[model samples]
Target: MTEPAADSRTELSSLLHDLHLISSEKPLPPPPLPPITELLARLKEKLIGASSDSETSSLIGHVERLFQTADPDWLFSLTSVNEEGRQEELQAAYRSLVCALIGCADLPLCGDECSSLTPAAYQSVPIRAVPVCSALRALLGALGNWEETGLLWSVAPPVCVFAVTHFQDQVWTNPPSRAAARSLQEALLRAGGWRDSTHLLVGDGRQREEGEEGGKSRGILGGVLDVLQPQLTKDSWQRCEAVKLVFAWTLLQLARPSLSPHLPRLLPPPLLFNDHYRPENCMLGARCLHHIILNTPAADLRQFNRAEVVYEALFKHLYSTETTVIQLVLSCLLDLLLVLEKPPSSLDPSSGRRKPCRHDDLLRLVLIHMEAENKVALRRVYASVLPLLVDRMGVAVCRHLRRVERVVLGYLEVKDPPEETNRLKVLEVLQRMTRAAWPRMQRRRLHMLLRRLLQLMDDVSSDSQLDDLIRDKLMSQTTLCIKLLHDCSPGNAQTLLLQVDSSCCSPEVLGCLETVTMSTER
Candidate 1:
């Protein structure tokens, strides 16, 4: 842990020790809850005395012995007391007390001499404060301001994870406790609320981040992947089936760009096989991959030596039983295709295929989801994927362009007014074809496709009133065809242009097309 965090935890721990001492030692109150002013004053006095006190260790020992014995509710009640709406003081005090409780969880009593230590005895009565520690963090996390917050400061904060992991060790070593598991479940569930901010993954070296003030922002949980690995089921996939939800949630949190560098070690081996070998683990890994692709920059992805782990896993799961998994796979593949200039060799067939795999493989996988039931999302994937295939393989993908063209344009024919997303995708296919495939195609086929684009430009509704958005898209696409044809052969382009007629070719578009549709090849 960083020094500041250590210092914060130590101070909080000491303060809680005082609260324990004062409440238990002082003879007072019918129900003597110290008022806020007196409480703060007494705390200040102890903190000042603690600076020079030679008996500090003895005091800490007393608190540690009575850790579970004292009422956990004392600080909870005092910190939550309403003091005329002066919430800042309450929140400050609360933050310290909670951190200290988390510190208590961090305490180690593994020595053989410690007979009273909970783990040393298999059936010691449950520590009420121990299990509920996590729930307390969760409850307070839920009540805090998360809107403008980045991540769960409690989760992402420095020492808190160390404390929690220490608790996890005790839970693992002992006979199963329902109280601890239930508490952890609530904590993990609500713990997810803190990531309200959009985070960027820094893939360059992925080790640690440099702060603006030249400090490091590494969290306690960042380098602790080994501690989490067994729980991840990476080594033995079957053991943690009962705790998969908690495991999945924890792994996902750790997969954020900040924590993602450890993924190669943390994820299952031979990533492609995880889907069948362990479905829960595979899905969590896949979801984390989806988040990484969406949030991280493409240039930095190379730093992840095992990125193929993600693509390969997602690819195998393209036929997954779960719809959400397939959709996430498709989304991740789409991002990969769009962001990277070339397909990574992860898609290469081990049996020595004649050509490197391109977007076609991803497209084919996506095509499986095109049944009427899934057309909404997969259609968008299809639309986006087609252009990428054309751009990547050039004439190689167009060996049979007609079938592909039909599949894309088919979306436009479905409704009286076309879906804007699909129509734009059709235009994208046309745009890619004209840009990449035009030069190598047999002339007869090239001209045929060009004529089809002209027809789309002229496919005006019989009624005079047209949606402005559709008209603009239609005319812009026609301009692209005109540009492509002009670059191909101006006289031939003019012939197709004349067929557009004045009505669909509004003066603005016609003039724009006229200006650009000249033979520049000369």
Candidate 2:
């Protein structure tokens, strides 16, 4: 045998002998094993030099046995001969073991710049020699036991990065490896609290440039982002679902202020996904964007027209036929609009006339769509979102009232079965619009709206398909709509209702009006 092979055999035999002694001793003072750092270093060197599958398997078997037999407390316990020296030694040993196991598992740790072997190169290693799933199982076992020693936190950041990078990746094709990775992730998170855990995952954002301290302290998130950013191109992100999912998972764990600092690194992936041709990707991207909009401060999103860029991306989705995509886009646009321009103040009617903004543009588009929309599901979605848009528009809803009137009239006339979800939402919009733009709810408009609402009550009362609960709800909402119209344009709605020909309306419809008037009196 070559000299190096002889040395490797000698080292392996010594490690096995130590493990046997440690396992056999039932007494307190077991024979001392080699320092952990030296022991794991030797093991890593042997694994790297392993020439055949049998050698690799034998080495891995020894590792699994060591983890199973060694007592964690004894392994990490400080020696009295050099307590301070031993503490540092133990920490280094812990870091070494983690790094060794992660390498043996063939998981990517750093990108090409930081590592001697890039991910692509790591992929070239023989699977039998590396045994990725087995390494991950052994690593998880070590981490699970080490967690009780409290030494796990010292080495958590790298393990966290590995977990996240490996999390749901296509490279981890083995089901057992995937499960092992997931368990390791939960173990790390439990060892580190969520905020602190995510903090480590995102890193401090102060990554040093190359050649500076060898770029050793680049934040975990920054490093991952660097690797991921290049993969977020138009053609690339579609194939990078795992990358998108990881970014979404991390972004959701953070909120405003905390999330603001990382926006530059965090924003690109979702935008690419948002612009994808697939509906599922589009929806996922929109959800990520929505979380960003809700959690980020208005001022941060407004910087450098960031809000406008997001608005344009989401605005195009308004034309999407996918209900889920449209829903997410509408929600994202609503919150984003607040960043672009403040909501029109109801306290000042003049605010409505102050130059049209994107809110008007969006509402105009929605109204045009609503005017022609034929799908019941879409009508319900539009109806449900309309009230929120009007609330955001405040008195500015008056600008779209001409179209709003058309939408309300058309939507109310349609029969939304099982539950009048669309009609109910339209009534809510009408009530809010009346309160915001009471002055516009008048003259012929008031007469037309009141007549349609009375007709609706009659229509609802006569429809046998509606249950008692739905009928009552429809009558009550119709009553509230008329009551708001009357409240907004005092005396006019009541006068119009009173002047209605008795033969034109049913007694139930008329009773609903009576109920509104009575409630108004009270």
Whose TM-score is greatest here? 2
Cα RMSD for candidate 1? 15.0
Worst 10 residues of 1 by lDDT: 194-203
> Model 2: how far is 444 from its true place, Å?
1.8
Deviation of model 1 at 466, angstroms = 5.8
lDDT (tens digit, per residue) of candidate 2 on 1-522: 112234343444456464443354344332344556566667667767778757767777777655545554444544432554666666666666656655565533333221233345445333432344355445445555444334555566556645665656465434554565666667555443333545655434454565553112333455446545675665555443345776677778777556788898787778888887778788888999999999889888889888889988889988878888998888888888888886754343665345677888888999898898898778878888999988888877878888999899888888888898999999999989998899877678988898899889889988888989998999989899988888876678778877878787778887878877888788
Q: Rate the local accuracy (lDDT) of all candidates.
A: 0.47, 0.69
The estimated TM-scores of all candidates read 0.49, 0.72
Best by lDDT: 2
Cα displacement (Å) at residue 207, model 1: 10
In angstroms, the error of model 1 at 228 is 4.2
Q: Where in model 2 is the C-alpha error above 4 Å?
A: 1-11, 14-158, 161-179, 189-236, 346-353, 487-495, 499-506, 518-522
